[model samples]
Target: MKMNRTLFLITLLSTFAMQGQDSLVSNIQEVTQVADTVKKVPQRYKVEGVAAVVGDYVVLDSDIDKGYLEFQQQGVSTEDITRCQLLGKLMEDKLYLHQAVQDSIVVGDAEINPEVDQLMQYLTAEIGSEEKLLAFYRKNTLPELRSELFEARKSLKLAGRMQAKVVENVEITPEEVREFFFAIPEDERPVFSAEVAVAQIVVEPEITKEAKQTAIDRLNEMRQDILENGVSFATKAGLYSEDGSKTRGGLIEGVKRNSQYVKEFKDQAFSLLEGEISEPFETQFGFHILKVDKIRGQEVDVRHILVYPEVPQSSIDAAREKIETVRKAIVDSTITFKNAAIQYSEEEDTRNNGGQLVNPVTYDTWFDLTKMDPELSAKVYNLKPGEVSKIFVERDRTGKASFKIYTVTDRKEEHPAEYVTDYERIKELALKEKQIRAIEDWQNKQIKETYVNVNEDYQECEFSSDWVKTSN
Candidate 1:
């Protein structure tokens, strides 16, 4: 099926926010017609009228029309969603973007262009070809479509950042959490899925000193080739880098100090001068040689080539034997599983916590079977509480191999939400409520100070924020 135009744009432009289309050319003429013989000008000047102006940004009628189309495209029943709701949302987006620009929140092209390239590539394949994609959007050239997409994406990022800023420091206290939980009536409480707490002990294959030196030597050779022979770093990275970013010449843009990268990787990246490449350094993943492309304030653009040392068959066999010994010790009651994990497991995040695998989404011990890792869920399906699974080989997306054994530490059947048992989840909900209130309060105040003008048609529509008034 041909993709919905607005839905495609929304998917390409934003993470969660849906934005309006900015098509400059349309054939439809809604106004009074002159002589039939007189050629009518295209709708860009007259028919595609402005719906509202928020601060410096204008929301067009086309934007509202596309917004409604986007909702329908997503299979949402828009029967209850009014034109007023759509207009209000677009205005709110504009307000946030305006404030973000005023506040000097930076989102550079280095961050946006990569997304544009990816989206264009995806749209071209889905819509059949580049020409068809452009024709579908009524654009004359690729740059024109890209420019509109960039602006839309930038606006989405700005609004998101501004909203995040409002609630960045908002927190809920235990008292607030209790109050929020109690405020809900008994019957309105949420039901939780059956949950199981999973734990694991992992042992990765040990690379020999010879293998380690080989990888380091290989990186050194590549660095020298690039510096002396003047080979392109990107070309080398595309050819030899094992990291996922290899496709883009190992480019990882918009890296902040607090980005989720390993400490060693961040330290190596930040220590380099612009356009300078580093010697091989080791992170948890592998050895890497990094190049700093550009630094904008606290953010840096970087590219790196990752190379993992060759693990000999002997090393793999030895790791398997070592893990087998640990499992045998637990099975024979010579060592407890938690003690074994603390002493022998090599996965640092779980080793210190008795190998307890916290769910990344919930930040808790519980894993819902439906959403749990398929391999893990399958292995633990028949395991009783406290029984350990047979040792299994695991390979990550990068093909880094490891051996692991799992244990189901606890289990609970599906149940309605309970206060004591689901305190963390409840706390999250309360904090979210507090954050939403904080954002709404900020928006309310900002709307009073900002320029807002709605068209006469929407003048009578009630809005969540005071949108009809202009600031004194």
Candidate 2:
């Protein structure tokens, strides 16, 4: 399916405060338009017309018509959707943007620039290249598209900031959670699947001394080639750098001296004269050779080549054995699992949290079995509470191999959610609902107070909100 790139863009651009159902509804409105595929401008909408005016900003009919076509192209059924509803949404967005300006809410270039780059990357990849994308949009260059969308992007950020401000202090209590859970009809209550809470101790496979030296030697050779054999640093970086920016010839721009770069990297980079290449140096990731490209005050642009060392089979075996020992000690009760994790586990994310694995989806320790990693699920499927599994090797998302031991801390069979067993889940739901209500209330008041005007063309459309009645 050609994803509704426009809808995706709208959602990505706006950071609404109301989550769950309310957020979904707001998002739908934000992107709604006519029920037609966007192609060459239709004769009806070709004659430019005003849709609505909210405060200082005006919604153009062309905007809604374009969004409608883009929506249909994304495979969305706009059969029941209307232009009036779409215009209402556009006006709502403008209302938030107007208030944002009045309140001086600002989104800096640093924040928006990355989002723009990411969007460009996504569109370029989807359309098959920069050239294809430019042709599709009838533009000469990528920057032209960016410039055309810049205002829409700015308004999105502004509306997001305003929404965030409205619900910044909203919260829900335990009693409210209980009340909300009981209020749902019995058949409508959430049903939870079998879940497990597990803890783990992880040990990363280490790169051996020989492996480290080999990487350093390779980087040294590259540096020597650049400095003595007249090899271009950018060419060498493109050929050898392991970093993501290697595609851009290993070039890094707008780097500040005090940024989070490693001390060794920063010190060497700042000391180099423009166009000077550094001798190879080692950091946690690997060996690197850097060349200064430009300097402006405290910021310096540079290019680099990085080579990562491979962990050997012997290193993997050693790490596995080390974790096995820790698991044995825990099984023997020589030390508590939490204490052993704190003292010995190399995995930083879970070590301090007593090795407890939190579900990324729920942000809780309990995970639905179906949502767990298949290997992890198999290992713990039949384990009783407090039972520890044998040591196992697995690769993380980044493809880094590691050894780990799993302990089933708790388990619960599939059942309807109850007050005692699902208090946390209920509390989370209640809190989200409370926040949504707060946002709704705030939006209503803002709409009532804001100066809004709907054109006669859209005055007869049934809108969810009283936008037409409230418009001055």
User: Which candidate achieves the best TM-score against the true structure?
Assistant: 1
Candidate 1 segments whose C-alpha is farther than 4 A from its true place: 1-53, 56-94, 106-161, 168-183, 251-277, 291-303, 321-325, 328-334, 359-383, 390-392, 419-428, 452-472
* True-vs-predicted CA distance for residue 119, candidate 2, Å: 10
TM-score of each: 0.65, 0.63
The prediction achieving the highest lDDT against the true structure is 1
Clashes of each: 0, 1
Model 2: residues with Cα > 4 Å off, grouped in runs: 1-162, 173-195, 227-232, 256-278, 291-300, 320-344, 358-384, 388-393, 396-398, 412-424, 445-462, 466-472
- Cα deviation in Å at residue 355, candidate 2? 2.1
Q: What is the C-alpha RMSD of each candidate to the true structure, in Å?
A: 10.5, 7.9
Q: What is the RMSD of candidate 2?
A: 7.9
Model 1 clash pairs? none
lDDT of 1 by residue, 128-185 (tens): 7768878767799877987887787777677878877877789888999999999999
